[model samples]
Target: MKKNRFLIILTISVGLFLLSFSLSYQLITNKSEDNKIAKIENNKLENDDKNVEIIKEEEKVSPNTIIEQRILYKECGDLIVTNQTPSTDIINMTKEKYENYLTNKKPFLRVISFSSNKIVTWGEKEHLCNKHFIIGEEDGKIAVFKIGEDGERLLHKIFVDYPVELLMELDRDEIKKGIRVDSEEELSDVLENFIS
Candidate 1:
């Protein structure tokens, strides 16, 4: 009877040891699956960062693009071409209208039509127009240009300091005061800089 009891206890201990080993194996397998899930989540986060970087690159737009878009929407009569076709009878009338229109107190950079109603003005700020349009530069002494409607395609410096109501009025008189008469040599130097 003593021997039989010892054998029964030994068998129970072996069974308990086997059960503990199986539980540990299951725990290790579960931990490995959790690590795999964590790795997948980390990869997803990295992909999200790459997508954000691409979106930022697409958002960066050039200044010229913004200016042209504004021109399309704004009432720009300053860029109107004086000579329009299909108006053989009204040609003289159109010229008279343009001349009377330009009898303002300040200089005009460009004029745009306001949806066929009236002309809109531009270049009221010294650098605003240049910064936006990038067409021309101050002739060191003075900036001058004879503008018409059709030259919109031509990239010229836009003078933004003109009056909103009248293209003749300037925002500041300092621009004129700063002008100095260029000598023939100075003029040649300025011309060379532009030509090159």
Candidate 2:
């Protein structure tokens, strides 16, 4: 009876030990698999972030076709002009009145000023020689005028025009090349090169 009882207890203990060992092994294997999956997910997310950054960089380098409109103003002495009139009276001005304004040169200092919502790409360099300048279309051509400080002398008259897209591209290229057009002559040359 003693031997049988001892054998029975030993069998039960061995069975319980085997069961606990198997369960512990399974739990460890499952935990290791979970860690591996978490690591893979983390790596995937990091790769995705890098891909997004590359995509954003590509977009920045690509040429965008969106056209941007800007309001430019030309100021001469006391007069300010824009492509669109500021008031009804200026809009209703007669041809004679317009002609007279253009023909009658004011004796006061002819300080030609320019204002625009668009960034001035060339103004700082031009400002070195001339106190004031005008950038606008004249006779269907883009023109720049450098006015003397005393308002008596027209220092420069530069006519430069190209397709708006081409002009923008040229400006971008110039920026990349670190090219600066300090004088009207240089501007005319640059425009001619781009146009041709």
Candidate 3:
């Protein structure tokens, strides 16, 4: 009976120690898993910061370097490609920003792109006829255009908040499609259709 009591006590002690060890191992494993997750999150944040830095670098422009530059000018039926030395202002702007400012903009474009020694820019104003520019009514306002040699009008300028009543007074097809004149003075004469 004494031997049996000793054996039973020994068996209970062994079981309790094994239970405690198993619980400690489970806790260690959970802590390791949590640490791994934290490291992964930190790496992701670092990568995101690096990506933003890269984008900022890409947007930076050298302020003093002279790059190849050119303008695509429309003359009559021909496209005249003009190569030019870039100004300090042009060198300061990124091509995408300059292009945005000039896309559908007037007078002359700021810059287009850079490739093959031709820095890019363009403004399509027709030159085949004597008229340097044309004017007409469109989208509820007076607008001006540059015609290609193909005689297709390209948007050049627009008038905002032009009187609706004055626009209604115009029925002349020449003023509606466009008026061709030799200079800005003649262009204004045609513009009279939209005015008093």
Candidate 4:
């Protein structure tokens, strides 16, 4: 009887030990799988964030876009002028309309004289002639002038603040006729000597 009892207790103890070992092994494997899944989820979130940043960068406006939207102007000392019409009008102006505008408009005059003694002479001719369109502002206000056949009849007032730019467009014919200036000084000299 003693031998039988001892064998029965030993059998029960061994069975309990094996069951506990199997349960522990299963728990460890499940914890490891959970960790791997969490890591994958974190990586996916990081990738998503990077993708969003790239999209935002692409949507930002570029300098070239801003430049394209604004009219191109030429810069002289404290003055900006353009031969072209206002940006809005130019966009809608037909070639025939532009030619008519030019034919009816008076020529613009600009003068700059820098002497050896540092004396500077600057002026402009904004005669009304037939060109009544408001090309642009001298400063921020509309540049107003009267029709004049000579520089003396042109206005000498400063329309805007100093250091302004003017935007102008020349036709192919005008360019062929030597209507282009290499610099502001050159433009001023040409205007001072212009016959028309």
Candidate 5:
């Protein structure tokens, strides 16, 4: 009878010991989790404070920001990038009219994108057109030529055959000084006028 009573006491003591150990382990893990949460909130607050300082510095440096951009015009596998500070006229223009004003300045060009630090454009195309056409008489025919990016004259093709009469129709010096057209479409228009 005594042995059975001792066994019961041992079982009860073991059960109590296990329950206490489980409670202590749960409290330790919960405290660690709470510390991690506090650290995360502190880091977030620090980042927010840094962001506020950056905004304050920006306001002091340029209360009225001046925007500057580079214009990139592309056509016929050629690209031109130019930096510009917008004029008051351009600054006052509405978003809808902005592209129109740019196109009017270079009618051959059309805006492809208006992005940060750059405005991209693409224009009319012609084989070997580097944006400049030189019209002159070549081999007894009215020939078209392109001024290369490197300033070399590359013959494009002949337009129509003509005698000296065609040359006389132009400025006396134009025949010698070289005729320049801005685009491929303009080159065809000039030839059409001469043919008529």
Candidate 6:
């Protein structure tokens, strides 16, 4: 009888342990799936796209055709640029910060600025510069450009909120050039000047 009682208790304990482990594993797996679903939903929101407009015959026109071309600008955040040309380390750091900032509600971005470059972003406003300096905006993500006196240029984006100390050391220039043109032809001219 004593032997039987000991065996029964041991079997019950092992069964309970296995059951608890399986339950915990399932819970964790379900939580991960839920997180993934949330991410997918957010991505859909980010990619909110519209149809493109192309001049064509009346027969080609459809109700779904977008009449007014829309340039979906990327959401902006509070970010500043620096005078330093970005290195591999800076790129990695900036990319990580950008990702983090995008995942959060509001984040500041600190970007290293360089001389003479045109940086393009999907953000609300297009920012341009020729001098090595920093520009700050209320928008979180900023693309940085550095163009040299020789007309060489590079483009990079800052995706995260960094400390002010890193950006404070650099100089800032606010002189605005022709960033917003009324027509696409003028935009091309502006871009040409930027690259040249």
**TM-score winner among the candidates?**
5
Q: Which stretches of candidate 1 lie over 4 Å from their true place?
A: 53-196
TM-score comparison, 4 vs 5, better candidate? 5
- Model 1, range 74-139, lDDT digits (tens) per residue? 222222222222223222233235434445532443444322223333433222121122113353
What's the TM-score of each model vs. the native? 0.27, 0.28, 0.30, 0.28, 0.33, 0.25
Whole-model lDDT values for every prediction = 0.40, 0.45, 0.62, 0.39, 0.62, 0.39
Residue-level lDDT of model 3, residues 112-145, one tens digit each, is 4543234555556534443468776677667888
Two-way lDDT contest, 2 vs 6, winner:
2
C-alpha root-mean-square deviation, candidate 5: 11.6
RMSD of each: 20.3, 22.1, 15.7, 19.1, 11.6, 27.8
Where in model 3 is the C-alpha error above 4 Å? Answer: 1-76, 88-106, 113-119, 128-196
Q: How many clashes in each structure? A: 27, 1, 6, 16, 0, 20
Error of 2 at 14 (Å): 0.3
Candidate 6 residue-wise lDDT, 1-196, digit = tens: 9999999999999999999999999999999999999999988866664344557532222223222211222222223332233333224233345335434622222212211232122222233223332223223333244433232335433324532223322311221210223344654453443333
- Candidate 4 regions exceeding 4 Å error are 54-196
| lDDT of model 1, residue 1 | 97
In model 5, pairs of residues that clash are none
